[model samples]
Target: MLMERYMRVSQAYDKQVYTEDGIYLGKVEEALIQDNSRIYGWQVRLENPKIKEALRGKGIIVPHTLVRAIGDIMIIARVSIKKEE
Candidate 1:
């Protein structure tokens, strides 16, 4: 479902997050907000097995600008996979 309006941050907790291409990234662990009271991003816990290994102990931070939609799940614009050197 398309979100009609802004939602409370509390409503977003535990929601599964995915890339536009359908790769499961993780769940919404926390929301990042600006001092002006605007949400700027989210702190997503790594859940995908492959990403978990690459991320090590680091958490994923998705920028709000990349967010495509919000509903039962949050669909984000596809993120480029960065290969480790």
Candidate 2:
């Protein structure tokens, strides 16, 4: 819950994440913590079909620093998604 404001970790999960430009990215799957004190990043399930297929069904990790705000919905910086051949 270190994104802009703070909240319970439980409240963090299942939050729909979006890019700053308002593109729906995914939902918060897991929060990456460090040493048990700090959160480093978030593991987000790929909801966008194109991104999901490009990621091979894997999730994306958004760094904590990129997070702008968090509440009912989480806002973060735009992430780069490259579809591999």
Candidate 3:
């Protein structure tokens, strides 16, 4: 489940990001916030072997909608994140 209240954007930095399936993707590099001050997405540095191999060093952008929960770590929908070329 999602958090019950708001969170400071700075708190997300360095938080480990992982897939719901438990694949360690990377750490939080930045958070994309809209002009309205809402978190729109997350910019995660590539770290996982498989995901990095396919993504080719490019950072991962996970939309807020794909985020299942937020707290100690970030969990995203892996299937959709692996948008292979």
Candidate 4:
């Protein structure tokens, strides 16, 4: 699904998604938007301690371009930091 379609249905504090080799990462604390209009990505809150231990933080931003799918939940193409650089 397109990010714009997701923006129409989803809201803040909704679950954000993460994946690496098809594994789930965590849920979202907030959804980020572009120009205050469509969703640009999200602010994901890490749930697993293993992930927390790895990230050394509570949350991170994800971009809409990285989104692979949106079904029962939001799906990201890969697991990563907020930005590339």
Candidate 5:
């Protein structure tokens, strides 16, 4: 017999997040929802030491489109963030 793993929104909180390039980005601080059924985005609390200087005092919002996988940790695609003017 085989079992399947199912994800729950509640379990996402505090889960570690990483990039496909192997960058330990941060932990899942919060999640956004749309229409009360779809996940809109993820608010990741930046914590990686490698990019600390660039991301200091900034929280990353990973859009659902960028999310690659959701298992032990969240895996997101490599993306460039543009500052809003």
Candidate 6:
């Protein structure tokens, strides 16, 4: 089942993530997609309001590929900006 497969992929990933956590952080400015490899993940751009509000001034970019499923809820791979670039 496609849905099942997607669920598995999503469940395998998608976890809680925080920026600096100590101060006002930023928002997702942009996303850098990693297409060279088949892995799932992306690099997020942190700037402006996104940065000001970000705990770490680091935005999160979830790869569309990692998003194995998007049904009642949007699902994605458990990825981190630290692990992206």
Q: Tell me the TM-score of each prediction against the true structure.
A: 0.82, 0.81, 0.82, 0.70, 0.82, 0.29
Query: Positional deviation of 37 in candidate 6, in angstroms?
Result: 20
Which stretches in model 3 have alpha-carbon errors above 4 Å? 1-4, 82-85
Q: Higher-lDDT candidate among 2 and 5?
A: 2
TM-score of 4: 0.70
CA displacement after TM-score superposition, residue 24 of candidate 3 (Å) = 0.7
Model 4: how far is 30 from its true place, Å? 1.1
lDDT of 3 by residue, 5-56 (tens): 8788899898999889998988888888899768888888887887788778
* Tens digits of per-residue lDDT for model 4, 1-85: 5445534435535564658456556786666778977777677777767766777887767787787776556677664555212
Per-residue lDDT of 1-85 in model 2, one digit per residue for the tens? 4555557887999999898899887899999899999998888887888778757966888888888889899898776433223
Once fitted onto the true fold, the runs of candidate 5 whose alpha carbons sit more than 4 angstroms away are 1-5, 80-85
RMSD of 2: 4.4
TM-score of 5: 0.82
How far in Å is the alpha carbon of 32 misplaced in model 4? Answer: 1.3
lDDT of each residue in 1-85, candidate 1, tens digit only: 7746977898999999999999997888889899968898888877898887876744678888888989899988877333222
Model 2 worst lDDT window (10 residues): 76-85
**TM-score result, candidate 6:** 0.29
Winning candidate number (lDDT): 3
Please write out the lDDT profile of model 5 over residues 1-85, one tens digit for every residue. 6644677888999889888988887798888999999999888877876565576555678888888888788998878331211
TM-score of candidate 3 to 2 decimals: 0.82
Per-candidate Cα RMSD to the true structure, in Å, reads: 3.7, 4.4, 3.3, 4.2, 2.6, 8.4
Number of residue pairs clashing in candidate 6, backbone atoms closer than 3 angstroms, sequence gap of 3 or more or interchain: 16
Cα displacement (angstroms), candidate 3, residue 83, comes to 6.4
Whichever of 1 and 5 has more TM-score, that candidate is 1
Give me the overall lDDT of model 3: 0.82
